[model samples]
Target: MTQSSSEEEEDKVEEDKVEEEKGEVEEEAEEKEHEEVEEEAEEKEDEEVDEAEEEEDEAEEEEDVVEEEAEEEDEEVDEAEEEEDKAEEEEDKAEEEDDRE
Candidate 1:
């Protein structure tokens, strides 16, 4: 009976050791999964930041185009005014010559 009891104790110790190793393996797997999830989240955030910067650059380019168009319109208006002034000067000169005649 004593021999039988000693064998049973040895078996119980082996079972306990297996359980402890299994628990450790499960913990390591969980830690690896957590690290992977954090890395993916960081990558997504970086992508979002890049997208926002690109949009800002596009908006600035559009603003520059609008300003250039406005400057061209102002130049056209100035040219039209100068033409009208020349026409008025020619009419005054002709009237003065007629009065002298």
Candidate 2:
């Protein structure tokens, strides 16, 4: 009877140790899962930031193109006005000569 009691005591101790180890392993796994989730969130945020920056760059480029086109149109208008002024001056000179004749 005494030997059987000792064996039963050893079995209970072994079960306790196994339960403790299992608890530790579960805790570690939960911590790892939490860390992985945080890393994934950070990665997603970085991707969003990159996309925003790309969009901003594209918008700036488009604005520069529009400004260039506006400048070109202004130059064309100035040239056309200069040509009109020259034509008017020639017409006025011809009229003066005919009046003298």
The collision pairs in model 2 are none
Q: Work out the TM-score per prediction.
A: 0.79, 0.84
TM-score of candidate 1 versus the correct structure, residues matched by position:
0.79
Top model number, TM-score? 2
Residue by residue across 46-95, what tens digits does model 2's lDDT show?
99999999999999999999999999999999999999999999999999
lDDT of 1 by residue, 56-93 (tens): 99999999999999999999999999999999999999
Residue 84, candidate 2: how far off, in angstroms?
A: 1.5
Candidate 2 error regions (>4 Å): none
